[model samples]
Target: MTTFDKYPTVIVSENEKDVWEGSKHIVKQLKTVALDHNLIAIECYPGIDVKKLYHDVIQPLNADETIYAADLFYNNHTITEMIESNLTEDDVFGTFSPHSLEEFLDDKKVKAVKEKLKSNQKKNIIIYGMGASLFSNESLLIYVDIARWEIQQRLQRGMPNWRTNNQDEQISRKMKRSYFFEWPLADRLKKALLNQVDFWIDGNDIENLKLISKEKYLQGLSQVVSQPFRLVPFFAPGVWGGEWMREKFDLDKDEVNFAWSFNGVPAENSIHLQYGDCKIEIPANNVVFYYPTELLGNKVYGRFGREFPIRFNFLDTIKGQNLSLQVHPTTEYAHEEFGAHYTQDESYYILHAEEDAIVYLGLKENIENEEMIKELEEAEVGNKDFDDEKFINRMRIKKHDHYSIPGGTIHSQGKNSVVLEISSTPNIYTFKLWDWGRVDLDGKPRPIHLHHGLESIQWTRDENWVKEHLSSPNQLIAEGEGWYEEKTGLHELEFIETRRHWFSTIVYHETHDSVNVLNLVEGEEAIVESINGEFEPFVVHYAETFIIPEHIKEYSIRPHGPSEGKTIATIKAFVRV
Candidate 1:
């Protein structure tokens, strides 16, 4: 079993000061700040508990008057109609919305709230909740933030979305609504207000809140991108989940199985900042929002503004079942239907596999598209089973084998293998065509999107095409005394380039004006150091994902401690430019 550090943290500073812990200290700070500024605005993200925050902080301060920003929103019926186009009748998919937060608020109510705040100047007034910052520019603003992973957890635990009461809705539907509508609206406002906020609060943990000044928060983000760092990885159980992550990573044994380890997707992960001995958790996307040019070089930022284009994650099916038969939308289809700039072009690198492991990829030669669609439709309605062997090609897989899967290619990962999935940032556009007549862990049939899948499938990509372009040939590109680098397959059609390095001595690397993401695929431990000693040496273990920012021009890696004098390997991915 390998020892994986699940909760990795970055030490922002050695000095032990400037962190407020617990509700009492936070309330005290708010009260002191309210003495000078009467209009205190606490702007919150969607998943935050406004009631809990009011009870804990505002109630203690005993403000003479309070205004809730949520009260200014239009009625639930009008708001629903406004976003109905984005939230389609389908349960699993929705179009992305380009609306702002102000669109949801009632104009008359907002004007009334402004008047109330102005009239209560002598009464020590406070305004709190989502869109609270829009009331006044001079008010003392506190932005409350939470990670997307935390928001998903809350939704699973029966928490409702902001301005709507749908706590009993299905988890997948709620997530779709948030992804296509709620999150985009909130993120736009956050990006505009983050630079000028007075204070920032980490509300991931309700009982233990952390407060800090905006200067300290931005400084912590700056320290993070200057060197190599890891995000806090989170694990989730799925219907086809496996036992590999549970056994090897020392995850919870009580759970049925662990399927995914979201290691490098910044939007769904979080970063830890240690001030002295106190650690504060904040959304990882904040780094991308604040330092786009510094974190993702000029070239990458120009292509995808304020977004992390590359993603690294793990899909463990070892000793488990096969993944659903699925296909992703093409770039044009994704842009026209979902308002996404780019589609999900991905590749799978086999980390570990059993002897009988296999992967279903592409279609067999001389297959009819109408015949395959007919069988899938029949299987969807339980009329008959879809005979996958009659139409698809199944390729046996082994350790270190790489397979490139661009958008519109039909694919599925078979059982008894651990796959490192490297892909673009739009992670939720999968169109599952078939599910083998199986139900989810909740005893409900998983939604199938046969219509969407049929529209996106590339019928010309048959077995011959996959054999020529998708599978890795492991072509040797460069060699040194003790190290050699090989080009791994990510296909020319994909925007990400992948390279694997096998080394016993130090191997040098340069970002070349683009951010790089890497994994220590083979080795007990390795050490990464800056060529010019610009930052401290960072150590990584087997199967751990880490990032090197664009600012770090050059670096080197070698086996360390237990793996000294032994050969190790790393697989790295970056933008094609």
Candidate 2:
């Protein structure tokens, strides 16, 4: 059948099983759909309790056994058939990595299941799992979406703590494993299947699960494609978590504290597409893949393909402790060592700060390479504290201050500060040099990457050099009756650039060849609208990051309040020539 002919079929697919609604509700939904046709519901799940699902869902729904259960179909081949054993680090880190579901397509066991779905001669068949929806043609697809944070909360509440017995240990283990180790691969598989879906359900909303249609979904995408878009922020806890974001943002009080918010790192965050009165959430990377040029423009598409090259996130340490001293690899080193396409060149934009706020940046002026290395080595192996002031320079900062951090620079956020980190898109690959002789909540010494830090640190970034170059000196670039723009000299190293705008009236701007990453750092709220009446206007609030797509050639921003004459300050970043 042609692609256009396949739009009518509706396939309900979930990224992961809902914590509240198990197979019982899903199977009941399937059975209700099966009443008028010869229907079969295939449960294509592994690493799960299939027998429990059968007793709980199938037996209750299937009175005459007309709705056949294909649960054991995956047993045709072992799990080993889906992945290569004893993979080396180099092999795993290489480019051209395929998602886990992509590997299943080649296995003969999957082929057998596909043939069974075809040969059953049923007018309607429901295949439900990771890749189950991919087997059929002319079917509408449904994706059930959930955030990684919500999944952890559900797991902690119900599931057995397999990794640890200690509460702190379990939380730490869950954060580390869930975010970096396990979910990345699983998310890759989910993203691979997202484009094929016709509807999406917010799995977190068990009471009134919003079912979004493909037409409405795509229509929402089109509206936001060339306009300012923001993703649903995902939060996580840290040992140095503070009360600022937890109280100011009104987050879940159950969390230890809100430490980080994944604002616009597309690979690690998802966007919510508004559909009439409902909303659908999909991986932010899907938008880049679906419309690369529209989101990233022609120049970016030609250079980076579908990769969104910038990330905006928050690091809150107000009334908390200092972050670990860390360094990221240079672009050349990242490509050669980890096979990464880009390096993380970051900057700290202090959104709010207490009286004693200070940032650890670069090394002391007279420190030699050997002394620094020896200090790091001693700290890593013996949990010994370095003479922080003798080696590391602590620069005092206040709200609205910007600190540049190119790759290879040693830096960390200090206590009593809430920083908006603007950087390149590379998320992982930090080499922690020290954690200030402190142990994690589990009473274990946190990891210190001595070797990698030694290799990546650019020793030239001394105290004087840092003050001269990394310190942002804002300069006025343009001004009008009630609006003005200032160029914030963040860095020119990674093709990423930033500017600040203070405007009381509507100020016009254009995205010439790059997408715009923006936040209302010093205002209550603001509205973004197209200059030529093309796309609809959108509102952004304080400390919230939003994007203006490359397709939005011209747009304007105005302060959003009681229409008085209060100035609004916004920070905007983008790729530059």
Candidate 3:
């Protein structure tokens, strides 16, 4: 049995001294803060239930007046008109919005709310909602934050987008609106207001809320970058799901199957901070937003700003089905169509595979692009079963095989294999060409994007080019006592580089002024320690992904506990210099 930890937490403190739990305790803290400040503004992320918040915290506090930021926003129709370009008619894809949160507000209603706040100066006033903090900076600012994964779950449960009534809307459409329109605007505002926030609330769990002071929150973030840590991994089921994770990770047996595990994608994962016995969960992206320089290094921060450019995730097809035939938009196409600065250049590192497992890669030699596109279009409409083997290259794969897939190169992972997908963070730009005539778990036909795929596919990258440039060959780079390192590529066209290390004793590593993500691919247990005693020793098990911040210049890893004195291996990914 694999001892894979699903909920990994960073130990910020040994005792719980500054954390508050439950609504009653949270309300008591707010009541005390309200005594000194005239306005207590509780700014919320979208998908938060502000009405339930009013009943639990504001109503119990007995404030003189409560102002909801939702009331001051323009009507739903007006908001739709303002963001129509961003929320395109497409069900899956939308352009990123350039507008700010203030653009969505009604100036007249905002002015009126300001007048009301001034008139009630003598009384205790509370303002709470999405844009509550826009009224004043001097108010006691409390930010209620929920992770993107949590918001996605709420969307699946029929939660409407902010200030929009779409409870009956398809989940994909709702997610598109949030991703392109609401989330970008909200994240910009959140980053701008992060330093000004006085308190932070973990609103992921409605019944049980966790509150931490700004001092404690910053302290936790600072402690995180100083050491090797793991984010809380989230699992989801898909139409082509698998049982590897369900059985190995001891997941819920009732779940149909686990298809994907977001292990190192900070944007979609949460970080758990342990203070004594209390554990508070916050979005992992908060670390990227606040400590971009410390966490991402000067060079990476200069290039990507606050975005965590690289992603590490799992795509499980073991005992399930093949993924859709897909191609990611090229750099120029992604920028022109989706407002993305970069495209998804990815690589698949096979973690586990059955004997007959295969991977569908670039097109076959001398295949006609027009003919392939015509067949795909016809197959999409249920006219005939698409002959995949005729045009696409199929390669037999086994454990530890790696394949590089740059944008515009078609690819798919066949059934009975578990793939560790490392790529750029622009994950939603995949233009799926075909789905083998399979419907989604909802029994609805999956959406196909043959038009975009045709425009983006690189016809030149056929079998010859794929075999020559995409298949990774292990090239030994360095060797020391009891250790040897090999370059286990991400192709030269990709910005990320990968290295595999096999060691029986200690292996030294430096960050090279860039953040590094690693997984123990061939080890039962290992320990990572700071070379200069900068941080404590961190233990990891097989198949667990962990991050080493850019500032940790020097560290060492070796087999530990039961695996000590035994050869073990790890695969590490970092930005290319």
Residue-pair clashes per candidate: 0, 5, 0
Clashing pairs in 2: 6-138, 9-139, 9-140, 10-140, 11-140
lDDT of 1 at 219: 81
Over the stretch 352-458, how does candidate 2's per-residue lDDT look in tens digits? 99999999999898887898788778877784777778888899998999989999999999999999999988776678888888877647677777777788999
Q: Provide the TM-score for each candidate, comma-separated.
A: 0.99, 0.80, 0.99
TM-score of model 2 (CA atoms): 0.80
Clashing pairs in 3: none
lDDT of each: 0.91, 0.67, 0.91
For all predictions, the C-alpha RMSD in Å is: 1.0, 7.7, 0.9
lDDT per residue (tens digit) for residues 1-62 in model 1: 66688989999878646668788998888788778887888999999988888888778888
Lowest summed lDDT across 10 adjacent residues in model 2 is found at 1-10
Candidates 2 and 3, the one with greater TM-score: 3
- Stretches of candidate 2 off by over 4 Å are 1-108, 123-125, 137-141, 148-195, 204-210, 274-277
Per-residue error (Å), model 2, residue 222: 2.3
